[model samples]
Target: MDTTKKLPLEMVYHWESSSPDSLYMTQPIGHGKVVEYTWGRAVNEARRMAAYLKSLNLPEKSRIGLISKNCAHWIMTDWAIWMAGHVSVPLYPTLNADTVNYILNHAECDVLFVGKLDDWDMMKPGVPESVRCISYPLSPSNNFETWDDIVAKYPPLEGRVERDPDEMATIVYTSGSTGRPKGVMLSFNNMAFAAAGGIETLGVGPSERMLSYLPLAHVFERTFVELGSLYSGFQLYFAESLDTFVQDLQRARPTLFLSVPRLWVKFQHGVLQKLPKEKLERLLKIPVLNKVIKKKVLKGLGLDKVKLAGSGSAPLSNDVLDWYRNLGLELLEGYGMSENFAYSHMNKPGRTRTGYVGESLPGVETKISEQGEVLVKSPASMMGYYKDDEKSREAFTEDGFLKTGDKGEIDEMGRLKLTGRIKEIFKTSKGKYIAPAPIENKLMSHAAIEMVCVSGANQTQPHALVVLGEEIRPKAADEAFRKELEESFKSLIKDINKTVDPHEQLAFITVVSDEWSIENSFLTPTLKLKRNVVEDAYQARVDSWYAKKQPVIWQ
Candidate 1:
């Protein structure tokens, strides 16, 4: 793949001039209502925004904060920021006040662009009085300049602002599960390489369609949805709300779809709700009937048109991957981190490995460190962690490979199978180290389990804290439900223990009543479980759970 390509702003200009009337984005505003933006209109709006920012006469390369959900204006604001010669800092829409304040202050942002959000009241206190503010379609409760008024007031900026490929473009903050978020500085060249390589690897084109529902702040979504659309000229659709997700997906009929492991699991559960797993599996065995069944299932889920389906941001279970394959969808699993712009490795179509995050992309290098850490060297690697010289130095090796902090082994085929995070491995009282991720992945395959955390620390044996799936919660009070759950879990545990080392065997399963969510601090905005938070909340009860002398304990 060619590492040198036009930057994002250049692509915007190219598309604006070549495909002025072409649909760039379709945004859902309300029930059965949508607002479309053509390439010409989007560029004109961004130019106006750039003029307004230039009028303020901020310093060159000033840091600007963008906080919002996925929308047309969000992408427009990003382009405008770059066009105005400023750096973009994106904040997760679900972030709390403390983290929000930390990012704004640490990045030293001169202005903020607020857009459609769920909880502005929770985020308002974080914005400093010194920083100027601009609101998008929806304004925050605090008085601030609105996007409409600014565009109406300023004429579109004349002439394109030239930018070097190596210049800084955005500071992407990691969604930290254990500590404070770190800002990863990405340059235009880095993003250009990633976008170009991704297009080559995925074979997406201008005619491709996609539904953009994931948080735009996440690197996976930002690179795939925002940058991918700009480079490929694909039609982008935005979901109106969570309530309208199914309708939105149906309307778009996307040719490419991406989702995290949790959402994939939910998709499986939703299917099983209508057809029992056993019956579905049996029906899938019939030669002629299987085609009909698969078509029906895919059409019902609004993924019948998907040409490429992917799962990332975390490890996906082989069980889930196989289930999707059984329905005629090749669910590919890829691996990357915020530090690499998510360009490390991906499973190519028709050449996928069941359990590995496929071969490294073209022009990307990967090797296992002496301590079994996956290290990568690629054009898409970040410049460094912003404002943290020590961390930036520690992240790379003497040879310049970025230390991924993930323990893994490369196969003969050069595929990477991640074992677990080095720091997440725990020692049991029996003096054996146990990697919890593999066990958690296995437990999560159970129909009733939504999320699971395995921990032993200094205990006799490792045990799991399980959160019941949404479908099982309502029936929890019934004796029949309890009996069914006990039977299912007993068989599940027995089967799982048979495949693991003796030391890694689970002692018991503790089912918790509470749901894990971002609001409660149990999950990150990306929907990854916070193991530290989970252990802190339930460590004291581990002994009590073991003392019950039962295989299953309901809390």
Candidate 2:
């Protein structure tokens, strides 16, 4: 586990000396073009960038903003920031101008590193003119100082540089599903403890491969993929774009693949697009054919080499897990939040519950609060929120456990089954409280449904708003297809309703055509639904939909 309290930059130096020529990262540039970086070269570049950053002569421990999509340089820039004695502040690549302006000003950033983005034009204005901007390779514009220019202008930092374990490392802002995002400050000690524990517990090594596609701004990607690389030295691959994601996966052939619930569902839907679910299930019953079918399906998705698959950021349907399991894949679920460096509970091999998030990792302590909220205490827990003393004080217990807003239950086996968020639970007019998560998971089992939100506080009965999968969108023009879908959803709702209490039962399921996305502010960067934005968009019309007395209503 290498429990020595070493910062990430020191670990990078260790790896540079230990295995300098080892391939560290592969980045796809465009059509059939790639760039590979050895550990030595990667560190040399980071060192040079660090030298350039030092040349700016910024104050010690300054906040440096990095707004970039996933790329090899994104990782290097982060290392350079840490190496240059500054705290890195990563902003979500998909954020709008307002958010970009808000974060840079809020963090009091002095320099901004811009890299690989689709919305650089929209986000460019938000970067404060005073905050010196540096552009990475493959960046959309040439307006800012280029990374190559700086690297070519300076030499690599001569001697070894390191930060104290207690030094502030980074400030990761929340996804703002609750409200305005809060900056969660984490120290080098927190990162070290998390990386050491997670890598040792997972038994990952340098030989393993991983594809990094999720936003690096999120804590999960930062804590696991980024830091785990320093601790375990696994080779990483950067995806080019959405159009080439499949090819990128095929190129990497990642042995360890982690994804969110939304992408997992999309992948399944992609498979079902070619083959009917009923026919696939029927063929799986035959032993030899089932093997061939699973192999072909997995290979098509480029997940054939995956030894460990994972889903997180939100609750996933058990059916999705079961589908992957039936194909002999080890898909596990984990539970954690930004405040804890995302080093908390993870379902382990041979000790897993299908729907539960599984037991705590070696150093994580978990318990249910009086309000059924999940409270966690771990070595990876954040120092506190930056510039918000009141919220920071409110976020933890008197004894120092971080109050995870999630509502969960622990079984005898210590498995944690999250029900919903304490803030998400609402009461019906009948005075019975409803936790929408379980019901929503049950409803998501239907293959045609993409996203579902269960809501109706103070109403007679709870209702649901569902976004249909893309697979059915083409068929929607056909009257027969639409009728069949409404009937299918009606049956799905009737079946699910029988399992929950009457108050928790959904009065109707409405199919909404509105897209929920980060651009629209309907979803967070991690694809978590922003409940407030969602309801506010349609709450005024919901009463009329309810009065229609239809089992499945369409909007």
Candidate 3:
């Protein structure tokens, strides 16, 4: 109903208007103790934290760093920073000490709030001398002021600090797979618009429950999990850790869930582990048995409670989507980048597409350029690259549309199927253009596959680098497993070749180690494979493949 641009102040107003006793955060406090906060209490804490931040007398729009995992106090502190007229710079809790230093120094942060101090000791060497540090509400060894103490010392201001919608609100540092970190400046309206769009498309409401496990430092999680909750008045719950994700899932039984493709793929693998592919296929052939099994699977996965489930940040395999559909859960694919607040395109509930990233959300416009790159015009688009006007100029069109680096085609149903990254499409010496994503997706469709990247840069034919599923192991240290992998790759190649032109057919397959991961920088935080990195790592043997013109199996 709010047509005007939004600010964090508006959220406080809405929270105050809601039922005071509604649950806000449900998380284990300490030593397996569960604690919950009500909407009224959350708002009050945010107000007090806002007041404490303002008491520091920092300049308007001063950058404040928040180093924390996903938790109740993290969101409160973020809103407090903006409410106090400062910009928030969130750092991932699990980041390497070097990255933490890089982000803090790059943002020139004036203050740092440390949450979950277990890793803070390792990160302390990175904090600049100029910045002040404080711990969260519970650090008992506390020499520094705790969040609660600070709030008590400085109560909420008489009135809110009004802000313009276009003003810079947060500086999010993106550690893209191939490049150094870049600070992305997003306006208050960018986040607000994204949350609004999600609410409209998904019908988020006060009655809905959300489980917040993704890193809050990531733009996707900050916008979809945090801001969207504020907009819809949904109850948000945080997982204690990866070990407790399933327990947290059962506790929350979230009505809406969002994840990257990797998790969905893992879920599919988990299901296939219990029920073999051929057995599942045969069961589906039986009418009554199929329905009963599907219902059971959905209920077991906690997806039966999901009114809406979406995948984004990376391309999801159609195999995973089809498997979920077999279990009666319609998992939709979404497409977005950090620069766009991660909600440009989404498969709206009831009107959905499996492989495509669905239609543009309400109030957003998208088009494919002559070069097949996606361009978007949306309220949720980033203001610009922080403190980098030259980079910003090149990132946007002359008319101001955000040029997404993705290549895609719009189907008759208005859904967009991403083919590949424009920069990632490889050109061979044979004057053939190859898109790797389609082939990579096909390879990952196997239950025993985990990660894959395709490359043919400056070569005669394309090749694929793959990782086996977590449960799958080589048949033997000998050539047995390698031979089985080769046969599997051949079968996959045959199927993928049928779906594409000759230029795009994969020529070689290499089964990579199962060690590639987001934390290891092999992938982006969103679990997207970095093709440039993968290709560079395997550059030594690349030319020999073209000379041989035969698929070489590498273990």
Candidate 4:
């Protein structure tokens, strides 16, 4: 509620120090009780870890590889790496072994930090024989040192590293949905500026609680969860696993929640499944019934408690937004990229439009270029791509604005309505340009549709490949049921076609029984559908399905 002023980093730390006995970071996985690390405890551990890292005698600004899920120790290790005057290279824990090796060797890490060892055997092959890997919380491994031992051996430093705000702090490797991952170099000031801006805009205070499940390796989570929590003195709880996500959510009951669009789509589908399509449609037809339906659905998702919920990393459909807005939860869809520290534009709760990504964050400027590309200038923009000066040059304009790659137009209200990606646009035979993301988002927002891709590179018009939702798989599996599902998609596509130009209209829709998955290379770790790969894999089948001039089911 204190919109008048924003707290500084020193002030945030001072608040934390004042509550030395208050909980800082917590996890319930191994600890008998919810593992609580206080402000004093965290400071001590971070200092000792820093001292231990400093004793390694690595070169100044040496790259340190961090491969782990979200955990309290990850933060401590990051601080230690920073205090030792090294640059942190955060890798997605779900990345393949070969990719992991490529990133590890690419960074040429002097040391590696391990937490939540999921694929130890696969990951071990990639680690250089000479590179020392220290696992957090100590495990039975001759090659690794324990955190407790490292802290006990080295004393905490009297002062933290006097970092130059402009100096590189971390090199975050993107999930590389299209190609080999490139590390995006970011500075302390880049991250710190975004943290301050987000805290100010979102009103994050010491009283807020945040649950950490999204991979901290991603800049989106890193900025919002790691830096935001650290600078705001907020209590952070790490979820044990995907299986216990709901349990962890109930336990934390966070005030502020951030999620990707895929999760929001899933939540929307869950509500629809309970009410069913015909019944919900019938209910919505009546004004009084619509209000009652909205109230019941919002309360069921446990999102009723959320003061502010955000969807980002991918665009969310208007239908999903409307579903949540009907409830009391003010679900805002934000738009940003890793190069921008993942905080650029967000829809403020009270002020928002249906299709817009909302206004720019504080101290951030947004403009649409002549080519319709969204360009942003912000203090939080990354320094440059790591070791890729040419690529870095291409990412920014001559005037120092960061090209967002997304094509969009901003309204007078300052809301950014995304049209499509510059590269993702397809040209039909009629010479008309079709943006597939918006169309794909519409199909995906359907209750029965889990994932959808719209493409028609060399065709007359575009078509869609849709994956059926998990809950309705059995019902949709039967031939009779398949026909019903197909008809539903046909009607949905017809409606979608009405909204787009003739060349951009979908000619047919193909239903895929199996969902596209991250592990299968169809999606990125952040759950963004890898458009190229998905289209390539289903291209032949798509052609065959479309040739039928009817909805076709693919098992």
Poorly placed runs, candidate 3 (over 4 Å) = 1-6, 30-32, 117-122, 137-144, 474-483, 544-552
* Local error of candidate 1 at residue 548 (angstroms): 2.0
Q: lDDT per prediction?
A: 0.91, 0.90, 0.79, 0.80
TM-score of each model, paired residue for residue: 0.98, 0.99, 0.94, 0.93
Candidate 4 clashes between residue pairs 3 or more apart in a chain or in different chains = none
Candidate 4 per-residue C-alpha lDDT over 300-334 given as tens digits, one digit per residue, 9 for 90 to 100: 66554578898888888888788777665788888
Error of 4 at 207 (Å): 1.0
Judge candidate 4 at residue 147 and give its lDDT: 84
Candidate 3 per-residue lDDT over residues 1-555, each given as its tens digit: 562355656876667666678888886675567779887787788888888777888988999999877788888888788788889999877666778888888888989988864466667778877888878865325467788777778777556567788999898888567677788898888888888777777777889888887778787788788988888788898877667677778888898888878888887787778988999889988998988888777666666698788777788888888777767778888777779888688886677776788998888888899999999888888988987899989988987789998999999978998988888877887988887887888888877778888887777678888787777764425577767767877888888878888888788777766478655667765576876777777788667656666564654
Cα lDDT for residue 478, candidate 4: 85
Tens digits of lDDT, candidate 2, 129-217 = 89999998889976889999999988998788778888789999988996778999999999888888878878888889999999989
- Tens-place lDDT digits, model 1, residues 1-555: 232478888898889889999998999888599999999999999999999999999999999999999999999999999999999999999999999999999999999998889999998899898999998875446578999889999999989787888999999999999899999999999898888888888878899999998899999998888999887889999988888899999989999999999999999999999998999999999998999999999999999999999889999888889999989999988888899888888988888888788889888999998888999999899999999999999999999999998999888888889999999999998789998988998998887888889988998889999998898898988999899999889889899999999999988998999889999999999999999999999878878888898988989
Best to worst by TM-score, what's the order?
A: 2, 1, 3, 4
Candidate 4: where is the Cα deviation over 4 Å? 1-16, 30-33, 138-143, 277-300, 553-555
Q: Rank the candidates by lDDT, best first.
A: 1, 2, 4, 3
Q: For every model in order, what is the number of clashing pairs?
A: 0, 0, 0, 0
Top candidate by lDDT: 1
- TM-score winner, 1 or 3: 1
